[model samples]
Target: MLYIIQTTLTLGFVYSLVALALFISYRILDIADLTTDGCYVLGMAVSVTAAYYGHPIFGIFLAIIAGMAAGYCTAFLQTRMGVPSILAGIVTNTGLYTINLMVMGWSSNVALLKKETIFMLFKHLGIGGPWMDLAIVAVIVIGCMALLRYFLSTRLGLSIRATGDNKDMVAASSINPRFTITVGLVIANALTGLCGALVGQLQKSADINAGTGIVVIGLACLIIGETVMNGKKNMTRNILACLIGNIIYRFIYAIILQTRLIPIDFLKLVTALIVALAIASPSLKENFSLYARRRKESL
Candidate 1:
């Protein structure tokens, strides 16, 4: 049970970065960037390759750069090439398949089981323990949250938020919605790549298929957070909600896995069902209330 809890928290914290990325693109920029799946694999590919060369730290930076580049391509397609936003993301994502394969030396998977990773660095520095993994993930998550909070308070961040709220109004204010959108996506995808890099190192392996359905998972985390933490308008609250929601989601998964009530193959389906419920919760509640009221009136 303790091990399960720790695993859940570690995974939740690591994946919260993905939720944060989607929060920026989906919640803040109002763009459903499908580049997430590709960028995630891109990050893992880059990170594992770097780690294979004995530069695990440098691998993280390279992953972020690669993610930013992917974001730029997506943004350019939408902003400069007249491609629809969704279509631009799809194009970039599709192209990234080849790019990610190339980055992995034309392989579908790479193993880092024998490699030294960022987590191993902590172990080497006399911080080794069962809690070491959780501690490392917690530090990273907190740092990201703090940095994001500070960044979102800046003038440029306000422009991004404003662009999401009302593109026409931002244009009227001379904020250049195109620029804001581009910047927002770049930052969002950078975070996504970072998440992938961390997960690759943490798991000590990188697979081409690891990023499949990542966007859906991130969106589900975002919706779950919003539903649970509803009625909060503060940015900090909202950001914290993302992390908390991820933890809650992972915890639920852990519990379910332990129960073995369902087979492993259906886990993705379970996630989809959870997301569906979270997405429809508000409407479901409203309808239930209406039905109750109607029945009461008849009584």
Candidate 2:
């Protein structure tokens, strides 16, 4: 049971990174950038391939670069070619499938059975033995949170936030909304690539389909976070909510899988249902309130 919790926690942190990335693109930029699915897979392919060639750190960095490049492509299509944001994202996402395949040398998948990874470094510390995985992931989550908090407080970060809130206002203030969007996407995808690379290391393998449904997972985390936390007004608080939501979400999934009440094969269905309910909770609450008001009037 402890091992299960630790594993869930570790993967939760990794997923939180994806949530953070999604938060920037979807919530901040107000764009439904679907490149996440393909760019995430691209990261896994590049990182694993590089690790296989004996360069772990370089591989991770390269994965981040690839993800950023994919974001840049999408942004270019939107700003330069006047493509709709969704269409631009789709084009980039579709292109990344081929790019991921090429990066993996046309292999459908690759495994890192004996390769060294960041997780192995934690094992070397001899801290909690089987629980070391959780410790490593915890440290990573804290570090990422700190870095993001600092970044969001900077002058440039404020501009990005403003652009998300009101593009015309930011543009009137002499800030280029297009540039902000481009930079935001780059930063968002960098975090996403890091998440993908970490997951690849955790699983010790890279599969072509590994990134399937990642956007949904990320959105689910964000929605779950907002729902549980009451949507704190502070940016830092909201970001923390995202992290907490990720852990909780994974823990719930772990519980469901462990209970054996539902067949393991139906786990995805359960996840989808939970996410849908979470997303609809706010509207449901509003409707309930309205019904209550009507009942009082009728009475």
Candidate 3:
């Protein structure tokens, strides 16, 4: 049970980065950037290739750069080439498959058994076991949360938020909506790439299919966070909500797995169901209340 809890926490922290990325794109920028799936694999591909060359830190940097490039392509398609945002993301995502394969030397997977990774560095420094994993992930998550909170308070960040709230208003206020959207996506995808690189290092392997359904997962986490932390006005609180929501989601999954009632093959279905319920909850509640009131009136 303790092991399960620890594992859940570790995965929660790792995936919180993805949730943060979604928060930026979906919640802040009001853009459903479907490039998440492709950018994730791109990050793993770049980081794994770098790690294979004995520079794991450099691998992370390369992953961020690759992600930003992917974001730039997506943004260019949307803003400059007159492509619809969703279509642009789909196009970039489709193209990234070939790019990811090329980065992996035309391979579909890369393994890092016995390789020295960032985590291993901690182990070598007398920090071993699951505690080290938890500590490392905690530090990264907290640091990211702080940095994001700070960034979102900046003048440019306010412009990005305003763009999401009202694009026409922002444009009329002398802020370029196009530039804000581009910057928001670049930063969002960079965080996602960082998450992917860390996940690769954590698992000691990078697989082409690892990024499948990531956008759904990230969106689900984001919705769950908003649902749980409803009406919170503070940016820090909202960021914390994202992290906590991820941990809670993982814990729920862990509990379900322990029951042995569902097959591993149906896990994705379960995730979809959870997301559906979260998305529908508010409407469901309203309808239920209305029905109850109508029944009482009829009585």
What TM-scores do the predictions have? 0.94, 0.92, 0.93
Candidate 1 per-residue lDDT, tens place, 1-299, comes to 89988899999999999999989998899999999999999999999989988999999999999999999999999999999999999999999999999999999998986899988887877865888999988998899999999999999999899999886798688898779899999998998999999999988888999998888888888888877888248899889888988998898778778887788678888788877887788899999999999999999
Error of 3 at 162 (Å): 0.5
CA shift of 209, model 2, Å:
0.4
List candidate 3 segments past 4 Å from native.
284-299
Give the TM-score comparing model 3 with the true structure, all chains together.
0.93
What lDDT does each candidate get? 0.90, 0.84, 0.87
lDDT of 3 by residue, 178-294 (tens): 799999999889988988998998888889999998988887877778778872477776788788888888887787788867786798998888888977888999999999999
Instruction: Kindly report which residue pairs in candidate 1 clash with one another.
Output: none
Query: lDDT at 146 for candidate 2?
Result: 87
Candidate 2's C-alpha lDDT?
0.84
Q: In candidate 3, where is summed lDDT lowest over 10 consecutive residues?
A: 229-238
Note the residue pairs that clash in candidate 3.
none
